[model samples]
Target chain A: MMRNMQRPMDAMGRDELRLWIQQLQFTMRDLALYLDTHPEDANAHRCYLDALQRWKQALAAYKERFGIQFQEQVCDHTDWSAWVSTPWPWEKGEN
Target chain B: MWQYQKALQYPVKIKQPNAKLAKMVITQLGGPDGELGASMRYLNQRYTMPLRELSGLLTDIGTEELSHMEIVSALVYQLTKGLTPEQLEAQGFAPYFVDHTTGIYPVAASGVPFSAEVFQSTGDAIADLHEDLGAEQKARKTYDNILRLADDPDVRDVIRFLRAREIVHYQRFGEGMRLLQDKLAASSPWPKNPYAFNPSFDHECWKHKGRKEK
Candidate 1:
């Protein structure tokens, strides 16, 4: 009998990892906007920090496993042109 | 300074080309309450915003509107990706096709080009925030109208997402208004008409020190 268990991030496919990173990023952005207005809300601040940390970790994992998605992560000065040469997010369904 | 991130905020993989739907959806690109106008309004208003928080709010939301503008353009591009001259002419898209030929030009359904006259930047936080709140609703209503005419599930999914964002923006602007009111009520040298004094210009009204206004 096989059970449908959730796979860990390291074992996840590229698409799954991308989706996870996107979710965490969006959570952080939404909470950032909320905290901008309601600065005194401690609960929201905590939630934002948690989301931000997760986003950073997931983004790092994606960078290490796959190619760099964000340009800020690209630290190698010799291969600076790769950032421009790589397929953009809008260029969907391309090789 | 803004950086160009080459991606849609949400993916719009349009599988079908429907010219009729494209005309209606183009309104959100350049209509009176369109994304272009929305972005310009908030970004321009922020310079005179009384509080740093409110300025940041305008900046972030305005930036998001620029992203929405790209989304609208993507929708228009995908919906009119390929078609014969006859098909375009028959589907009430001849006028637009003659002018732009599938190029994403910001224009309303009525074919009027985008103009700066659509939005206002009053420099008064109260007035500007109210306008923003109203603008969000107008954009949401336009999306609702598009949803009524749209048949494709893919198109509806993207439109639904955009509409939800309008509601979220409206909520934030409302909170901004409440913050302004509370600050006004608690501050010194209070005007007979609290709404009369422009918080952006009047230094006294901006006196919320030590993290507490009261």
Candidate 2:
């Protein structure tokens, strides 16, 4: 029998890693917006919790394997730092 | 209704603490025209606004102000770190260190704690927007003061980004003002509008119905 072919989470590269973070941010923002209208939406509250978990896990995996760009706790600098010299959307005129 | 989570918005990496400058930043955090004020002003003003778009803008901007509060708090955190007794005596952080050791307390850099007076909610859109625009300008001035006082380029970059946000917010509120003006005039009664040459007072002109309608 043929099995479902799912791309593994570990298969994601740097750009994919960045996209994962973006997805987490989008979901978080959506939850925030949704809650404004449906403050008591239990399903929505559940989704918020789920997204937070996904973000935490994904960030941990990304930092362990490829290293972090967006977070401070995952930095490599002897001093506190981020690899900001690399291009990001704000500098690329995407903002 | 938004929940507060600590923001790691953009990674702010400061090499060393400058206790003096951190003190000033805290003043607005706790003082009038501080982030607490800015955030509350917009959030509270949102409920009374007749237009949905303006209300959305207020909520979005108010949310951003929360992030701004986090950013300044981070700066204060970084600035107040690693103060030994010797450094405290030398840099004039003795009083502050005595009170709070690296705990993020909202205070004016002048040492005042965060307070409700930092913001106003007048319950009128025009009055609120007027206050909002002025608030942005005041925030920009605070950034200017930060630039003048701060020697660290890292700190300056954050201050600059924050200053630019105040301008962007000002532009947005200005756009909001234009929209509100249009709505007010459109809501005005058409026939009595002496200023119908300019369509602004169309709806509002009717309210002075103290004069009998022609």
Candidate 3:
């Protein structure tokens, strides 16, 4: 089940997209921590894979609409410094 | 060898500047048992961990500590962003203000600079794992104290998230120690005392001359 119920990223504002992405990213991080200790847990593994796929989708949409989030996300010369030019996470008032 | 994540492990957005609160929160950045020491201790000790799983735990936990460090620093930055000299003096932040001028610096709540003397890396898996467990508790207590003093709901929310992480880390470290104990008990020459030798450094005795040398 897709965890995010927000409107499509294309229709959402910058802050809304960022917030949705943050939620999906957190789900992946939490699952990653669980799988580290219980690698053989089938249910947890399935949850992790599902979360991972959703996280990637949200992240791709975010970068496509706004800018790169991780350094490795940069794909072309036009995408250079996408990580740096993007707003720092701690910055308030805007995403 | 670690990659930087452009975002915080969680969000920290403090709308109102509160130098008084920032002064207390900054301790977690550089104080004894702070995230800086926590990260350094685990990452350094992992180099000598006997088991691959133990080392993996250290790597992941240590990396998480780095992210926590950033969150703490961001909290301090947001809290102290725009304070006048008068407000700083009134809030008892003049001392920190005179030195850093709203810039974030790592120092204990009592103003002691961060020191390697605060943490240990004995290179023994059991010892190191025990230390990691203790470190997590100390961190948790600090967050608890912060939660008690924090008035802003937003600040409290972030503090709660960080505090929960410490408990989780404590659980993971405890499991790592248990794994080490089981392996030692089953494989050690001195089966009775699971810690007969330091597994990370004891190469000769570790060959486990199965029947005992007696």
Q: Best-fitting candidate, measured by DockQ?
A: 3
Give a tens-digit lDDT track for model 1, residues B93-171. 9999998998889999899999999999987888899899999999999999888889899899989999999999899
Q: lDDT of model 2 at residue A40?
A: 63
Residue A71 CA displacement from its true place in model 1, Å: 1.9
Please give, for residues A7-38, the per-residue lDDT of candidate 1 as tens digits. 46798777777766666656666676777799
Stretches of candidate 3 off by over 4 Å are A1-13, B204-214
- Kindly report the docking quality category of candidate 3: acceptable
Ranking by DockQ: 3, 1, 2
Residue by residue across B85-145, what tens digits does model 2's lDDT show?
7776677777777777767777776777777777777656777778899999998998898
Q: After superposition, how far is residue A22 of candidate 3 from its true place, in Å?
A: 2.7
Backbone clashes per model, in order?
Answer: 0, 18, 0
The candidate with the higher DockQ, 1 or 2, is: 1
TM-scores for every predicted model: 0.88, 0.65, 0.90
Model 2 chain B poorest 10 in a row by lDDT: B194-203
User: Among these predicted structures, which one has the highest lDDT?
Assistant: 3
Scored by lDDT, model 1 comes in at: 0.80
Query: Which pairs of residues collide in candidate 1?
Result: none
lDDT of 3 by residue, A43-75 (tens): 988877876776677778877777776665778
Predicted structure 2, TM vs. truth:
0.65
Predicted complexes: DockQ each: 0.38, 0.06, 0.47
